[model samples]
Target: MLKIFLSSTYRDLVEYRAKILDKLDTVFDSVGMEEFIPDGKTSHEICIGDLKKSDIVIFLLSSNYGSLIDVCRLKEDCKAECPMKTGESHISYTHCEFKTVIAEGILHQTYKVLKGWDTQDKKEAILFEEEF
Candidate 1:
């Protein structure tokens, strides 16, 4: 059976994920982070594991960069554990996923979400694409 992985900003694409899962599950073994459990690893780590197993990956991108590996501002105790490392800057989970897709040479497709992006956020995804 073909395995497909879906990636996107969760909140904004909740509806999108549902609709696509409904359609693809009929024909493919489609999966995403929604099926994931809190299994001692971070969400980012879990996703990279799933992404490696996928036959194809479909990325739903918007102006929204999505969640961070560790949300410092949102957590009062998050200290210095959340900032991007020097000489290495990836603003969101989706950004890391995009880079991994390329590095792994995975067959993938990206669909721009015109409805969900937050116009106020920085366009870091586009910045990475620009380097390509």
Candidate 2:
């Protein structure tokens, strides 16, 4: 079973995680980083441990545009814990790294929206063509 870490701005995408999980569980054995960590545990050790166990990281970028908390403000925290690129805005980081990771021939790449019937089952199940 593939393990995937789905990263998105907490303030905006937290609710969306449930919808994504419903679809993901249909095929992959997965866990959300927030779910695995005990409440109030913000240590890098726990976060990185979960990240390390993940086989792929899917970033839900567009979903975070209206986030009130501004996850970018927590850049230092994320940098200390996660494998994602820091400093750059979330969307930029997603766009930049997607190509580099794919060029380096890493995990399967995708960038289009994928949540419930809003995204067709056939499209969601199949890997995307090129970058999104």
Candidate 3:
């Protein structure tokens, strides 16, 4: 079975992620941060490990950048066209995963949410809290 790693901002893309999992979880070996449990590994390392193991990746990009992580080491290790700016201290987890997939040559697809579609992440968080 082909494993798919879903990458996106948790808050803004909650609905989209849930929908994708609901629709695709059974059809494919779908893995995302939601399913991750603490295993004595940093999120960056865990995500990178998962991305390497996945056969393909699906990225849902939005205006939100997600949590910014220090990418100094990861950036240095990348051999692909990482769009990181010079002297940048941090990069978002979503962006990091996206870059890692590219750097490792993993098959991937991306769905971009329109900028005009406002992010109601805060409100959605409360409404969906424990709802799923």
Which candidate tops TM-score?
1
Model 1 C-alpha lDDT per residue in residues 1-132, reported as the tens digit of each score = 999999888887889999998899999999898898889877766777888889999988866667766631322321223235432453677766676677678899988877634455556656644533
Please report, as a residue range, the 10-residue window in candidate 2 with the lowest summed lDDT.
122-131
The lDDT for every candidate, in the order shown, is 0.72, 0.48, 0.72
Cα lDDT tens digits, model 2, 23-67, are 898999765655764656543334445655668867664432332
Where does model 2 exceed 4 Å of error? 39-43, 63-132
Give me the runs in candidate 3 sitting further than 4 Å from their true place.
Answer: 71-86, 115-132
Quick one: best lDDT, which candidate?
Answer: 1
Per-residue lDDT of 5-121 in model 3, one digit per residue for the tens?
Answer: 898889877888999987777799898888887898777777888888999998876666667775545556666454464763455677667667767889988777765346455
Clashing pairs in model 2, backbone N/Cα/C closer than 3 A: none
**lDDT score, candidate 1, position 89:** 51
| Candidate 1 residue spans exceeding 4 A from truth | 71-87, 116-121, 125-132
Ten-residue region with minimum lDDT total, candidate 3: 123-132
